[model samples]
Target chain A: MKFKAFLTENGVILLEKRFLPALDKMGKICHLFLTREHAFFLHNLLSGDGVQSIAQFHKEALFDDYRISSQNEDRIAFAIDISLLNRAVRSSVSICSELGGGGSTANRLQIKLVKKLPPNSTLPTPFLTFETKGYKSAVIQDVPISKPLSRTQVLELQTALDMAQDLPQTLVQVPDLNQLQNFVDRMKHVGDLLNVSISKYGDLHVQTSTTLITLGAEFRKLLVIGEQAFAPPEDQTFSAQTRSERAILRGDAQSVQVNVKHFSKSLQCHLAKPDCAFYGIAPQGACLTVIFQFFIPGTRQTDKSISLHCRLPVLDPS
Target chain B: MSSSAVDAEAPDLVCQLDNVQGMVDALSSVRWKRNQDAVIELSEHGIVFIVEETGCLQAKVYLQRELFTQYEFRAHGRPRFGVSLGLFVDCLNSFSVPGHSSFIEIRYPGPDMKLLLKSVDSLDSCIYAEVRTRIPDSISWDYNFEPAGSTPLTFTVKSAALKEAVDDLEWPGSNIQIKLQPAPPAVTFRGEGHGDLQIDLMYYVNTDLLVAFHCDRQVSYRYKYKFLRATTSNIPNSVIKDNRGSKLSIGRGGMLKVQHLVSVARSSTPHPHIDSAGYQQSSRIAYIEFFVKPEEDEDAVND
Candidate 1:
């Protein structure tokens, strides 16, 4: 296996300052999946509990020059401590900034996978090394990572990823994150589980209740995503009632009960400064998905280079 | 529904307060410990919250009826309930959004006998909370504080300076001695532990720092430092921000009574009300009082 890449100036700022720090708040360890086309940071994908987060970045978005080779169809996957990775990247950025005096472009940051003898041990260990080269000084940081998964293990992970990618039937855009955060923080004091309901009619209701009291907040007239924006074509009839039809007949919204802590952790994504955010609940789904959308600077176009979302595990109604 | 039916179902007490932040500040001033229970009593004149620490300390927060934008009471008698002090403060704080002064409507005896609070400012979204309340238990200690001498031996000092002096005296000390004398008209606070530290507020030195002084005779008493500290520890920033003064008076048997007045009016504009004389005035204020018993071992010294 071989992997090496030179991070662009924008990559250093985004990775070291925005992405990694936000991911660090979600979980301790993150799975770094490297493919020929893109890189994926997966959290709690293999675990059965906790909030699962996936952050995807295209090769050109971060890497100036990228190369990777492995037996598993040129795909490499390994787990590493999120904080350790963040620290290494942060140190590299600081070193560059110090040498360049404000323009990190003067320093070159290269990350590569290598095998070397770790200090206080004779046996060699696999490590991800970050090398920062300036005019006359160089700094290297070694961060230990889990051994690469075998071909079969990689296949299993791919299957899991495919299952998690299943999108909800309807998506609705939520309000400003700062407002939502303030509301959620207050709900946290009321109960452990938050009931989130989203309607195709662009209505969002969040509530928390205990045996002693019930608290709720409602946001109406939100923007519904495409196709689901209006009622399904009247001509298309079905043998059985669809989820949306059931919702309409019942005069209720699709609701999911999730841990408040998990929901709050996902809200930390506001640090990434997404252009907009959407919330959706899959039909008979066990998780509530929150997608953060980023747009290209100075344009109305969505930036397809980066995609980030979080899936919060739902609690059993009983 | 008939008008009579609607009246029967209406809450016993309904009030609206636009300055939620001011109420939050007053309640938080008495919240020294987590999970503390405060007994709330509602009367036609105002609402009172009584929190006590067994036999050592007691605090009362009085919110006058004038503090609210509208106060309506139809109950036959005073209604009392008990609630968690910390939770009450936190719930009120949520209604106050930063940079936006939200109006909150408070009602007692919600459908389930709970306290109902609703934010009535924004049209897009409405936030409502119901807090659980229990039957209030009988108060444990009630001490009538009569003047210790012919004249009330009281002294008033800037809240900020008083808080600073009390905080600075917290150095391995278990008890703090308060001394007041008419000669030269000065008040002294001495804490003795590893060493001795004394802070004196004299009438003639800086009138601004020592706002008021009154003493007919010399009086000295020692109080538990912990209980004394609780009085000034949580004086809300709003009080200090307005440059208010806290008055400390000594009653019979060396009981120390600390009083602070918190204005429960919007910072930008005060709530205007018409008096019987047809004059407009702002009378929105909350009174907070703390009564601490002096140490039993230390006898009071009077000359």
Candidate 2:
């Protein structure tokens, strides 16, 4: 829907579009300017009347009020709202230039605005002189000019008018396919770990709101610097500080075998299931140890061993 | 814009066939509206019709099991006059925020009578649905206000188009059946192996008809959600029933537990008769496997 532009008795022009109707009949027919907002205001003023009363004037003058050429004989011009046009205007002011020429006759219209001289102020009155060189310039005179309106100012003014409104509540950044797949995998694991079924699960997910703040110095050392920068020279006790003190407890490649210990024990016992009994005794209490270890893949790393200590009662050989 | 210009700007019907294919191609890749309660809309006759949003797991199953059935059918026949409905449904179902409905509208002209393609397989049907469903999109956050520990957060949730469909469903063929398999991970280490993991997927598809013989009649079904959970920890002291890995299913309700698989260690007790070595040998490695049994066996029926 296009906005209606109207000139008020105060000579200020407003560009707006609203669903108001009866503002026309209440005042003198010759001088009254009707807009959807004015119609809405009248609807409010009349306690019992519904939108129907205002709709009557909308049928007669709403279109005429919206037309750029249509003007009421009275000096009052009612502005109907056009948000798109307003947006274009607000955006246009930023890149607008005084340089105009070398275009078709249709592109030769120019608007001249003269800044009002402030009281007792010696600051020269600024005149925005629009001239189209090599072509006859259409001159519009006596336009009350202030500083070109900023987008913020225009938006503020536009918002001040009563209208149906909705605010943007969500903005989602689209993730690449690989990222989405990874996220889906992570979400599924989370769901599985939590013992919850994620049926009807959507491929789309809200990006993780979690953020990590690391010190500049630490981040660079931990993430950017390579292992060659801290390679130990084979002789002395090699030690290096990581981004966090916890890294000290969890030793890296160079410190892998520093305080490590290992034990290999053998025991002879009886075997209850003698199906393949070739290892000698009647295996009763067989001692067995399974070792679990963790290690980084490359760069001369050693496995960290954690033994599951187990003790078995031996036969009374008395 | 002039009429011809508007028509030029007007979305091309044939090109959208490719778009529909593109949507189907990257079905799982696109994020659906997160919440189970969200509605998806389809534009027909300039009016919006909303379909229901299924929760996470249910949505995956719906896409994998149900969508493939339609995708296969549409690919073979009815390429031009394809339903192309699941794109709208899948998009709404997959990407919306949890507890929120994603309002999406897929616009199309009513039937193009001038370019009607003769149906070789069977009679084409027009299905019109006027459905209204509510989807929850608001998540309540509870926490104590401590300036030191406080994290400032800004949250936005759009109200799902309450008046329109949250999901769209269509049958592109006479018979429909869909099966899904987890896509293999891009990178796998040569020697190292990882334990059991879950992967979620989706399919955006349309079918000409579901249950071919019943195309003459309307087969209506409501989409819902259910969650499943299970415990994979090999520790014995951990809570057996509750701590076991679980699955959360979302559909008609908000979040639900679909399944639970507890580690075998939790179930087995140490027996004096059996030594540690013996018990370790007998320890049944715990891992979850899935299987589905069809109700009506066509082979059996034929036999």
What is the per-residue lDDT of model 2 for residues A1-318, given as tens digits with 9 covering 90 to 100?
122332221111111222111122222111122234332221211122111111112312222233322122111222222222233332222222233422343433232233546569777553333322232433322322234334453343333222211111111112222322322333331111111000011111111111110000010111111121332223112111121122323322111110001101111100000011111011221211111112233533432221111111122211
Best by DockQ, which number?
Answer: 1
Report lDDT per candidate: 0.82, 0.20
Model 2 residue B258 distance off true place after TM-score fit, in angstroms: 22
Q: Quote the true-contact fraction of every model.
A: 0.45, 0.00
Q: Candidate 2 at B70: error in angstroms? A: 25
Task: Write down the TM-score of model 2's second chain.
Answer: 0.17
The docking category that best describes candidate 1 is acceptable
Question: Can you tell me which runs of candidate 1 are displaced by over 4 Å?
Answer: A98-106, A226-251, B1-8, B192-195, B267-284
lDDT of 1 by residue, A1-318 (tens): 999998888887788778898898889898899999898999988886899899999988899789999988889999999899989998888888788745555578899999999889998888999999887888999999998878887887778787888787778887888888877887687678887877776666677778766676666568887424443443123211133334546544578889988988999888777889988886685689999998888997899999999999999742
Over 4 Å off, model 2: A1-113, A116-318, B1-34, B37-58, B61-303
Candidate with top lDDT is: 1
Residue pairs in candidate 1 whose N, alpha carbon or C atoms collide under 3 angstroms: none
- Candidate 1 chain B has its poorest 10 consecutive residues by lDDT at B271-280
TM-score of predicted model 2?
0.17
